[model samples]
Target: MSQLDTAWPAGRDVPDVEKLIRQTREQEQQPVCAYIYDLVALRERAHRCVNSLPDECKLFYAVKANPDPQLIASLLPIVKGFEAASIGEIRTIRGVSGDVPIIFGGPGKKDAEIEEALERDVMLIHAESLHEVQRIGWIAERRQQRVSILLRINLRRTLPEASITMSGRPTQFGIDEIQVPEAIRLVQSLPFVQLEGFHMHSLSNNLDARLHAQMVATYLQCVQGWMQEYALSIRYLNAGGGFGISYTEPERRFEWNDFMEELHQVWEDYHIPGIQLIFEPGRYIVAHCGYYATEVIDLKTNHDQHYAIVRGGTHHFRLPVSWQHNQPFEVIAVDDWPYPFPRTEWRQTTITIAGELCTPKDVLAHEVDVEQLRIGDILLFHIAGAYGWTISHHDFLSHPHPHFYYINGT
Candidate 1:
């Protein structure tokens, strides 16, 4: 049987992740610090999301989440396309699959990046500002080519708040809703640019399923209003994704099925014929499939608070520290003690899991209660697939980078 079959015999909910972690630990000679990815789990999750999507909606993987080449390759067949925020991300996706559809979206895009996007014949360039639309037109005119684009709008309407708010506020992301009329006129006047649609991406890491559906409905309502008032002949409406992965409460996940049910109602109400809906989600797609494993090197008490310093810290997996939340972790007890002295053990205590960094801010989990933790035990961080390694500052302390391992179950 494959590792997946051995680990997940009954269902996906019950996985022997510890078995895989133990296997990875046994291979390392020194203190282990590595990232373990379950490709089977990733594919399963992607398939679930793809299956849940409505016929009007197209799923695209945002490359900013985890741009691992293997991860990108794995997601290519499952998602409709890849959404790249930078030229480097575009190149990274291209390196994985040359002809796969790509949509470039970001603020303050360079002229060269626009030219490159035109050269690549991307599905759409999400234009942030009217000036950016002008620049795209200029570059396309210079290249003697016509480029398709989606005007990314910063709508003025009140929006549901998220951890990171990209629009409906003063942000350097999209064009203001009031200025969208001028933008429409400019796009219509530009001979080299074909205005394909509108891109309204507002929130990041939004968890409420009903509220999320309502938000998408609100976006559709706003876009339809613009289409009627501006007489815009648009064929695509990109409602960017911000599906949340609950780090604080892992069991309470975002209800995609519930979201889908409400989304069907929204589609029935607002989906225009011949217009496609696109959702570019990054974190929710791959977070549960990854594990960051670090070996504990020290156990101490500072100011009557227990602490466990591991071989790696925020330098390797910085998601916990970046989001200011105690990431969920499981202790894999290792009995082998190589030291001449007795192994130090911290028992039945609430321990703060910290990395080997010199700074106090390098903690991963604070005041987390554990049954029994020792110097030789390993801490496996859960839900670390997306925005983990890619978002971390690896070279901060000039420490060694963690090893990466993938279980394809083939």
Candidate 2:
């Protein structure tokens, strides 16, 4: 059974969700750009789960999914910590929040990045591999400071549509589960190093809350078993985030209650004393809160195929290209076109949505249904708040980036 069946809220329908969307859209100012306040709502939902849990669990907002300064600034106070993938992201978090606990994630860490993280006094550094552990130690030794580190574990699990595979057969992230013993020995040998916990991030959307809970259970089991053998206990458990969001249909919702219930059950089954659970949620919190607004430049028809060429393309929102998923977009006339409703059979045709860029692969939607799209219309793509800004965009295209705005309060 899929996780959503058990984790989502019960008896909720699309109409209730649509009302919320329509209300937000009506009050929003135009040219409506991406807004990230929906992330706050998601955080609230996650907090419900965190608060209900028996153990001490902390949620860390992963900055890689959507690193808007304003979004991060708002979430810092609510969340326990922040997970940073790069030095720039670390800096961004530091600028907005002072001494907010941060976990330095990502595969490769340059010496300078490690030094900077050290200088900032980040709470934890998640070492992706043995080399990274030694490198961090070297940097920490140079700075005369001890660094608390977590060894990321490769669980040998496969995920669908993952760009970079981190487990199963020769993955590039963390030490293999088999290598944990050696990793522990290596950490024990270093006098200036402190081994805090084990970290694992498996791919999952909010829709698959049960799977997320199961993965977390597996991670805790492994760590607990290892600790039992070594007569040691970790202070933290970092279960990395892969919470999914609805990009195609805004009405399709995630069942958070069921997801949290499953998570609570898993933790209850394997209760560990004094180990704080840490979650790094990046996309689930921010994806729905954002939208990408573009102006329809022109419309053309060829061989019964209609095309709406917009000012923005894969350069602006990369999910259509990277994930091969359709984003829900509404085409409204910039200035209302005068038309009367005809009492005839209206036919919906499939059209290819293309971006303004020169690349042929810049197609946004291959086949979408619309009611007679015309020139000078505006298209607003929904649920583009996460992984939309940085995936397929290249500055070489030379097109100006889309302006970003946020709904101030709600």
TM-score of each: 0.95, 0.85
lDDT of 1: 0.86
- Strongest candidate by TM-score: 1
Show the colliding residue pairs in model 2: 6-258, 7-258, 7-259, 8-255, 205-244, 206-244
The superposed Cα distance between candidate 1 and the true structure at residue 196, in angstroms, equals: 0.5
Badly placed stretches (over 4 Å) of model 2 are 1-54, 156-165, 204-206, 249-254, 336-347
Residues 318-389, candidate 1, lDDT per residue (tens digit)? 889999999988888887887899888877899899899999999999998998898989898888889999
After TM-score superposition, the amount by which residue 61's alpha carbon in candidate 1 deviates from its true location, in angstroms, is 0.5
Model 1 ranges with Cα > 4 A deviation: 1-16
* Model 1: ten consecutive residues of lowest lDDT: 1-10
lDDT of 2 by residue, 76-157 (tens): 7678889999999999999998789999988988999999988988999998888888888877777789999999988765
| Residue 354, model 1: Cα distance from true site in angstroms | 0.9
